[model samples]
Target: MKKKLISMLMIAAMAVSVAACGKSTPSETPSETPSETPSETPAEAKDPSEMTIYFLTKILGNQYWAVVEQGAKDAAKELGIKNLVVTGLASEAEVEKQVQQLQDAVAAQADAIVLGPVDSTAMANPVNDAHASGIPIVIVDTMINTENYDAALMTNNVQAGKDAAKEMIRLLEEKGVKKEEVAEVAIQIGSSGSQTIIDRLKGFYEYWDANAPQTWTVLRDDVKVNDGDISKAVGFTQDFLTAYPNLKGVFGPNNGSTVGFVTGLKEANRTDLVMVGFDFSTEIETMIREGKFNVSTVVQKQYLMGYEGVKQAVELAQGKKPATKLIDTGVLIVDLKNIDNDDVQSIIKPGK
Candidate 1:
């Protein structure tokens, strides 16, 4: 990354602390972490000032969706739209629960729906159902494998993974770590089937295959799929590190798992182990500030996903076609140098 771009990333990370969580408003603060929690009612009394928008993510316990929800809540407050219950299954592996949440939202007569489908095909039925009911659905964070939805607001996951890979390579080069000597680098994926997770792995491996072919190789078996639980994330990471004595680094495709990986690394006192993970969580931010991890690939504008997701949904509900099928929210690489700096803290502060 260029110095200016790095500087900008740092700025966004810091800015996010205050705005990352739904601290600014209630709607975006997830009822559950990545777990999708749909309100039984899905709306208030339908106050004229507040339009209800229902939302669902991959899991409820993962902090990653918190940022996305924060984005949605921020938008609701700004637009006087009531963001319905923002919830999802506890992991990406649960497609049934995810679909149920969408159906619940639609049944409740939500004015609009924002869904982060666990499975592209599984979501088709519920998504189409919602659409047929005159409810507009918008996707954020992860992608639905099919282009069945009206629009997808997502992080540039490929670039996110590539950014992390670049940082890992940079750190390795800085430490005089030879590429060919790497025996094992564990891949901690959120979900193998999810397009977003696949993209992250693809981005990292693609970069290595093209530029560092001889330098790196993935210990695919060492990977842990938390499906998106923090506890599971921590446990998987601990087990991977324990079993793999020669492990050099850990890569996670999702925020909860990556942050959990860092926690496990911290507990193991393996400060030397490199971590190039995804999502911009407060835990990751602290580690980035302390230089505990090598680097973190962050989707800085999480709040925008919720805010803009609602904005997009509202417009679409009014019969306006969103300008794009996949809105590519940018990604960033955050590290120690400017983690606590005013500009850097803006977008990545924990629990903000």
Candidate 2:
């Protein structure tokens, strides 16, 4: 009986040891619970260095284009772009040259292009060709006749013209010149091919016809086509002043024309004539400060147009589309009264 009892106790101890070996130990068990949830992946960032933008202006060596170039450079630096090339013809009438530049940009494998066309219709084919080659183009300052561009950034030119007219009216009133007593007003245009110039003239005419007294006549015959030549503008203004001694106001729809008008007025000692024009320059600023005949100028946001044009082109190159195809950079009327204001100063001397 004692032997059987000892054997039974040994058998129970062996069973207990077997059970302990079959069970998992604390060290063998995992410390973390396996999660059933999935994690979200982040979007990849774009590489700006791979993008190259070409800026083709209507003309170079002008203050307006220079400001635009500076704005584009500022954007390129800020965006870390691989390259920003600015090129254009010497004259605004060089439509064929601009077309060649567009083709060259495509041949160079530019990622995108920003164009201020010399002629709205002449560049349609080249713009379409660029679009066909998968290189996006953004129109700036001026609009092309085609709808193939990725985007167009410009000012409300018609409104800008109306703004100039309104300012002219104000200045005439301040000078104690009654609308009926006013004999004539003359206008100067930079380029007849430029849609921007046409729209401005249209706006100016629309406003003046509706508001001015019936006796006041617009000197349509005296209208001069300067073709961006300041000397032509000056000569035209001198002739107009000599012909229309009763001229109440003069409107220059561009920088060259405005500058020419101011210079001509000074030379002729006819600073008493109210003048309103388009664009901004150091000379225009000085004339305004000196309280000359320059009543005000309708200044477009040219820098913004350039900066935004490049920005949109870069986005297009990166496979992104702009929220809208048309963007108005806006315009402001800068006169002696508001020239020093912060907003006016900002537009007048952009990126300062």
| Among all candidates shown, the one with the greatest lDDT | 2
Candidate 2: C-alpha RMSD after superposition:
10.8
Taking every candidate in turn, the Cα RMSD to the unseen true structure, in Å, is 20.4, 10.8
Q: Over the stretch 1-352, how does candidate 1's per-residue lDDT look in tens digits?
A: 6999999999999889858664655456666443344322324223424567787866665576777777777777777774457776766778887777787887788777888778766676677767777777788877775555787887787877787777777766665667668546777766666777778778887886677647466786556677666788888888887887777777777777787888888888887777777767767777777765566555456766777898887776655677687899776666776556555556665335
Off by over 4 Å in 1: 1-50, 213-215, 341-343, 349-352
Candidate 2 backbone clash number? 0
Lowest lDDT block of 10, candidate 2: 33-42
Candidate 1 TM-score to native: 0.79
Please report how far candidate 2 places residue 180 from its true position, in Å.
Answer: 2.3
The local lDDT score (0 to 100) that residue 244 gets in candidate 2 is 80
**1-352: candidate 2 lDDT, tens digit per residue:** 9999999999999999999889966556544422311111113334677777899987688888788877888889989986888898777767788889999999999989999988877788889998999898899998788899999999888888888777887888888887568467888888888888888888888998888778777887657788787788899898888878788889998888888888888788787788897789877887889975647888988889888888888888776778999998898888888999999888878868
